[model samples]
Every structure is written in structure tokens, then in C-alpha cells.
Target: MNNWIIITPEGITKSPNDTFYENFQVLGFVTATTKEAALVKLKENYSYINGSGFDEVWIYQLRFSNPNITYLGIEQEEDEFEDDFEREMVHKITCILEENCYTDITYDYFEEDSYFFEAYSDAFQEVRVDVKDETIEVYDRYIAEKHFVHFGDIKL
Candidate 1:
């Protein structure tokens, strides 16, 4: 299976008295055999309402194995972590050897021991994490490096 990113147009309402705002929203990530299958899977899994003012959903296949280009979003604050585990995990993930680099944790389904992250400097980078035997494997596609750290080693 391959990883894919789904994006859709969304309208946000700040408050009852505010006007509706339009923007592109990331639906989520899905794994499938192909792009068409990924779209079908996403539509079936997510209750996305299709209608006026909303553009067609855009799907992009993520090249995790040998990714050279990735999306770079705004820098996120480190204080978003709710606990020590999250804080440590984010720290370890974003410790890239690049100057002026920014990292965004796109997905952090920690309950499933899975994470999706993107980092940017001169080029975009993607990182995927998988946990096995209490050890987390960090795959940094941009640097073409793999890092393994035991969960116990992550000081809480």
C-alpha cells in the first residue's frame, strides 16, 4: 500500500456574527493501492459533504520511500504538546541537521503509534514514524536516514 494525502476546500465560520471564510483543508491521510482507490477509500471513510463553493477534492500520493519534495507549512509552536511524551517525541522528530528548518506534525495518532511530519528548509522533507517492540523508527526521507529510539529512552 502507498500513503496519500487528501485535501479539500473548506469554509470556516469564526463566530455567528462573522462572515464565512474559505480555505483549503487537509482531509486526512489514507493508505491504498492506487490513487483512485485512495480517493474512493477517503470518500467512503470521511463524511465529506460536497456542494457549491467547494472545489473538487485533490489527492496527492506521498513518496515516503524516496521523497525528494514535500509540502512546507507554517512553523508550529512547541508548546502545543499536552504532556512530556508528546514534547519529547516532537523534539526528537524535529531535530534535523538543517538551518532555518520548520517542522509541522501533520498527523500524530499516537494511540496507534503512528505519526506524519513535514520539515522544510531549502527543500521539503517528510518523516514517518512507526513503533514496534516499544521502539520507534523515524524515517527521515529528506536526509535519507533512519533513526530508532526506544520508548523508554524518551524521558518523560
Candidate 2:
């Protein structure tokens, strides 16, 4: 009851006006059953994640079994995971996703996390500094990172 896979969470959510918000990009899971419907769902999520927010792309692979659900980190055979494996994993089962949780192997690929840019960056990849007005901005759009500015920081 074990399907090897990966789970990478980046956080992809932004405002329509290209403003910075609680946005991220990260989801990599190994799929089981290979159902066309399931595949469609996965692909849709991937597209939406990549299409939105700064061009931050995250890909995860997931392979799991019935009861042995596992959301492996990302894939760092040598490195250890930051998540508390046994402690964080809850058996309450919130949403039964294909009856498969994750695989035994997991690693993380923080393409744009705290380590990538400023520590407080919501979307680190888009983090930028404006010398014209001495302002800090986290570009929210891949097509237009300059479209957004801190709500109150925009000097009139």
C-alpha cells in the first residue's frame, strides 16, 4: 500500500489588478489510477498555477497506495524535509483524494520561498525594489510585475 510520489507547495494566489497578495505556486504529486478524469484535474491545476502569479513554476510527482497516504516533500534524496512527517500528518482525512495521499519519497523545490528573496516576501520571486520612489514591491505578474505596488505605499 505505497505509491511513490512528490508534493511541492509554492502558494499561487494573486489579485486581478496585478497586486501582491497571498499568492504562491507549488504542487507536485504522483498520480495513481491514471484515470483520464484525474489526469485532467491535475493538468488543470498545473496550468492555473503556472499561468498566474509571477512566472513561478512548480512540478510535483505523487505515487501512493490506499491507507499508506503520503505527501512526500519534493525529492532530495540526500537532504531532509522541514515538515514534521509523523507529527503533521493527520489521519482525520479531510478530503478523500483518490483514496491516495502521497508517496514514500518527498522533497521540496522552493523556486521562490523565504530563501529565494526577502524574508517577508509573499511572492519572493517577484520581489523588487523601486529606486524612483524608494518602495518595495513584489511583482505579481509574469507578464507585468510592475503593474502592482503596495496598497498604502503608492505615493500620490
Best by lDDT: 1
- Per-residue lDDT over 58-117 for candidate 2, one digit per residue giving the tens place of the 0 to 100 score: 433333233343444756455343555311221111111113221222222223221111
For model 1, residues 1-156, the per-residue Cα lDDT tens digits are 988877776645454458667777666567899989998787665544333345677899887633354546757675666688866765664553222244443544354676656654323456566655555565555432245232222211
Q: How many angstroms is residue 58 displaced in model 1 relative to the true structure, after the best TM-score fit?
A: 0.6
Q: What would you estimate as the lDDT of candidate 1?
A: 0.57
After the best TM-score superposition of candidate 1, give how far the Cα of residue 74 lies from its true spot, in angstroms: 9.6
**What is the Å distance of residue 26 in model 1 from its true position?**
1.0
RMSD of 1: 10.8
Off by over 4 Å in 1: 10-21, 48-55, 65-156
When summed lDDT is taken over every stretch of 10 residues in candidate 2, the lowest stretch is 89-98
- The per-model lDDT (C-alpha) reads 0.57, 0.31
Model 1 earns a TM-score of 0.35
